[model samples]
Target: MEWFILFIVGVVGGVIGSLMGLGGGVIVVPALLYLSAYGLIGDISPQLAVGTSLLAVIATGLSSTLAYYKKGNVDIKSGLLFFIGSGPGGVFGSWLNGFLDAETFTLYFGIFIILVSLLLFLQNRLTPVDLPKDNRVMMTYVDAKGIEHQYGYHLPIAVIISFVVGCTSGLFGIGGGALMVPAMLLLFRFPPHIAVATSMFMILLSSTTSSLTHLYLGNIEWILALLLVPGAWFGAKMGAAINTRLKPVTVVLLLRIFLLIFGLRLIIDGLL
Candidate 1:
């Protein structure tokens, strides 16, 4: 029963994370913590939860990146550039994660999740930035509908943002797409599909680095991570397929509500 639930958690995390490029850590880390607290799983500490979640996230990133790439949504050039900063940031974040205790991890993760929920709500509301053409490094995409969209960013700024995203990924086991996707949309003017795809590419790279760091620290729960990988991998493919087929507005709204409620629960648990 526990194994079944863990697989389900992985599937759900992969689907949602791939849909929005938000990374499965938002789902995986919290679920592991909750289950561990109930003693349904083995003695899992905060570090183990984060480390295991990141491993699962690697599957999600790799699976989703492949799916997105076939659709021509991935911006390979920009992804490589962003990796310049995100790679090191992920390493640093994983190192930092070692310092956190259970109570502190729960509280901080709760706050971060709430902020992520709010960020999603507010992401579409942000007004577009007007940058001079010469200052912007541009890329253009033609969507399935044959509509062309132009997006660009300041190279240094993009790298800086990716670094911060990577740090959060390493520290929290999130793929860092929650912050990265929106930043790409608002700051870099990336199309939604492009932002998500590119963010997943970045996630694949950073999660690999972060997971290696965790592996060295002996933080990952190997058994749990293995169970999660298959589900996350396939679910990510399903998510990419669903995204290309239709927009599930109702599902997204409900997901936000779940995040809010779950995040609040974590805060209460930490306080208690």
Candidate 2:
């Protein structure tokens, strides 16, 4: 029964993760924790939950990547550059996780989620439909379709950001796409759809390393992760299909609402 519920959770998480390029942690972590506390997820340790979530992200990333690939939205050149740094960063973050307690991880995760949500909200509110140039950390490349895309931040800066994002993902059992997508769009100047695709591709690298490290350390719960993957794959496809149609401002607003709700939940949980 517990297994069945976890599987259902995975499906729902996967669908959301794929659609939003959030990498599933935003949904999976809180849901798992809440369910576990209620004894709805069976006998699962908090560390196990974290580990399982990381492993599940690997599947989510792959599913999202494949979905984005089908849409021709992924930017391989930039994604390769970002992946180089993030791949190892995942291992480093996972190693660091060994040093922290479950509460510490949860608290930090909650805070980070809240912060991202706020950033998304601000970006939506401040940036007009036809926003001007923002050269904070830009990069540029030509896509397969002959579109010469310009992004913020050079390759080196993106690598540096990837390292930090990877560490957070490893430490907190997240996919880090939530951070990566925004960074790509707002900081790197990639379009939102392109950013989502690229972020998914990069997450494949980080999540793979993180999952492997966790699995080797006996952190992952295979049964749960497996259950989550199928649903996530379908969700990713759905998300990719909708990416172009959805307005960036609307997406940000919705994502912000999700973040606010999740953030408040975490804060309340931490306080209680």
Candidate 3:
């Protein structure tokens, strides 16, 4: 029964995470924690849940990234830059995780999730100002459907944001797509598809690094992770297919609602 539940959670997480570029940690971590709290999983701590979720993120993110890549949505150069900035940040975050106790980690994780939810909600309301032509780096890319998009971004800002996202990923076992996708849209001016694809690529890097660190720390629950992987892999492919059909606004709205519900639940659980 527990294995079935974990598989279901993995499917849901993989679908949503792939669609949103979140790598599924947003779903997996909370679900694991809840299962542990309910005594369905014996002696699983928040730290272990987080670490295990990151391992799942690696599989899910890679699966989604490949799907996105075949569609020509991934910006490899941009992803590489973000990866460089995020790698060390992931290490730092994982190291920090060791210092936090279960209760404090739960509280912090809940707060972070709420903050991410608020950011997603507010993103649509904020208007973007055009940058000077000289200050921006131009991008031209073709999508899965052979449609081309042209845009520009501020590279330094993107690197900085990616670094922060990396830290969060390492700390909480999230893919950082909740933060990175929005930042790419608002600050870097990436198209929705590009943002999702590129974020997944970054997640692939960040989650790998964090998972390795967690493995060394003996934090990951391998049995649980193995059960989750197959579902996550299949769901990622489904999500990548769905991404091509959905409007960007609809995606954001759905993600906002999902984040809000999960964020509030985490907060309530922490309080209890």
lDDT of 2 by residue, 1-272 (tens): 76666666676666666666777766777777788778776666556776788766777778778878876778877788887788888888888877766566667667888987887666644442223344344456576668887755566677898988787778777788877776776666777677877887887788888878888888876777777666666666666666656654565577679788888777667656
- Ranking according to lDDT, highest score first: 1, 3, 2
Estimate the overall C-alpha local distance difference test score of candidate 2.
0.73
- What is candidate 3's lDDT per residue for 23-68, written digit by digit as tens? 8888898889888888987778877987899988888899999999
Per-candidate TM-scores read: 0.97, 0.86, 0.93
**Which of the two, 1 or 2, has more TM-score?**
1
What's the true lDDT of residue 30 in model 1? Answer: 91
Give candidate 3's TM-score: 0.93
Per-residue lDDT tens digits for candidate 1, residues 140-241, read 888888999998988888889899999999999998999999899888889888888889999999999999999999999989998898889988998889
lDDT of each: 0.90, 0.73, 0.85
Winner on lDDT (1 vs 2):
1
Please list the residue runs of candidate 2 whose C-alpha ends up more than 4 Å from where it truly belongs after superposition: 1-4, 126-148, 248-252
Give the number of the best model, judged by lDDT.
Answer: 1
TM-score winner between candidates 2 and 3: 3
Model 3 poorest ten-residue lDDT run: 127-136
